[model samples]
Target: MSPAQAMERSYATLKQMLREGAFAPGTRLEAIRLADELGVSMTPVRDVLHRLAGERLVEANSREGFHVPRFTEAMLRDLYEWNSALLIMAARTKRPGEEEKPIAPLWEVPAGADRIAALFARIAAAAPNHEIGDAIAAANDRLHPFRIVEQRILERVEGELEQLITRGSDQPHAIRRYHLRRMRAVPDLLRERGEA
Candidate 1:
């Protein structure tokens, strides 16, 4: 593979691993070790880390290298609220001559975090503003880890996601309630992850 391909491979791998919680929050990511594990050179690994850091999926410190960000309760709450705001804005903002699209049936979507993420993405895509979609996508990446924790700790996660998918992008109230449930579950999610 070419150098660019190698770097893209490293970036995609690291991004997927981070979303899947392969590295715990606050764990330092060593480029040398990751390069060895990824079967790529350290240069690509370093570049990938910097790119992820720019997206806020990885935290970087010049002295300490890169680490997965450890979320405080307040930080998580704010992120959830911010995501909620983005989704609500998307729901309310429709482009001229844009028609509403029907979401896939709940059964078609995988349960848990996947369902939640997919629904949110569709809602973001429905918005007229591409920036809102991009923001929601970033928020999805940031919240992916916590969403996995919520699957283990929070009750009715699947049902809640089903409601959001069913409600579609027209109801800002439903979007607010969906995120509010997640915000309320922050404590449980933290406790389950032993982060509290």
Candidate 2:
């Protein structure tokens, strides 16, 4: 593979592992070990680490190497609030060029985290601002692991989403409830993973 390809592969693998809670917070992510684990060169590992560091997914110290952030319950609530606001913003903002589709009846599909994500993505994409969508996506990257880790939360909120789509009630209220499900679910999940 080319150097860029190697970097991309390593970056994606590391990101997946992080989301899955494969590494605990404060665990040292060494370049050589990770390169070997991902079947890539140390160069790609370093490059990916730099990118993750930029995203605040990992912290780099000159002496201590990269560390995962200790994501606390309060921080999780803050993210939930930020995410809820984003959904509200998206629901409120009118997309300039795109004609708004009536909200999809998402309940027809089998419910899961991915399905919930697609639902939220539809809400987010309606926003006229590309920057808002991008911010939502960036937050999603940090938040995806929680979705995977606790699929039940998404499953639990399926009815709220259906109501949002079917009744066409206020969009932000339903979206806030959806975000709150994760906010409520994270504490137990973090404790289960011993990351709390």
Candidate 3:
């Protein structure tokens, strides 16, 4: 395959491994070893590590190599708070007197983070401002990794999302509460494993 394809392959493989918790947080990654593990050369692994560094998922230093940053309790809570604010902003940006599209009832919706994300995406898209929708979409992608770890939180959020979508209401408190609740569990899990 071409060099670009090799890089893409390495990037995807490494991203999946990281998301699946293959390496504990705070572990330093070696490009040569990773290349051997992924059946690629060091070139693609280096490129992929730099890309992951850009996403803040991994840290890179020219002299010291790559390190996976640990997610702190405060850091997780802050991310949730910021995401909650973005969701509220998306709601507030809606034009006045705009009629909301009908949404499915709570019982009809499926459980899972993807569903919860779709619900938020729909709510954000309802805003007349295109920028609001795009911002929400980007944040949702960044927050995707947390979904599997926080299934309980997502389950609670589904009902709140339904209320927001159907009634055209801004339920920032509900969103923030849902996030903070999940924040409690993540820190414990990460800390117990010495990953935080």
Report the C-alpha displacement of residue 29, candidate 3, in angstroms: 1.7
RMSD of 3: 4.0
Candidates' TM-scores?
Answer: 0.92, 0.82, 0.71
Candidate 1's TM-score: 0.92
lDDT of model 1 at position 181: 81
Residues 34-120, candidate 1: write the lDDT tens digits.
999999899999999999999999999989999999888899999999999998888788554434455556358777777788888
Please say which candidate is ahead in lDDT: 1 or 3.
1
Model 3 bad stretches (over 4 Å): 94-111, 117-145, 152-167, 184-186, 192-196
lDDT of 3 by residue, 57-122 (tens): 788888888987676777766766777777777666766654544555533556665677777786
List the global CA lDDT of all models. Answer: 0.84, 0.74, 0.70
Model 2 bad stretches (over 4 Å): 96-111, 152-155, 164-169
lDDT of model 3, residue 13: 87
**Residue 174 of model 3, lDDT score:** 59
Pairs of colliding residues, candidate 2: none
For model 1 the local lDDT of residue 67 reads 94
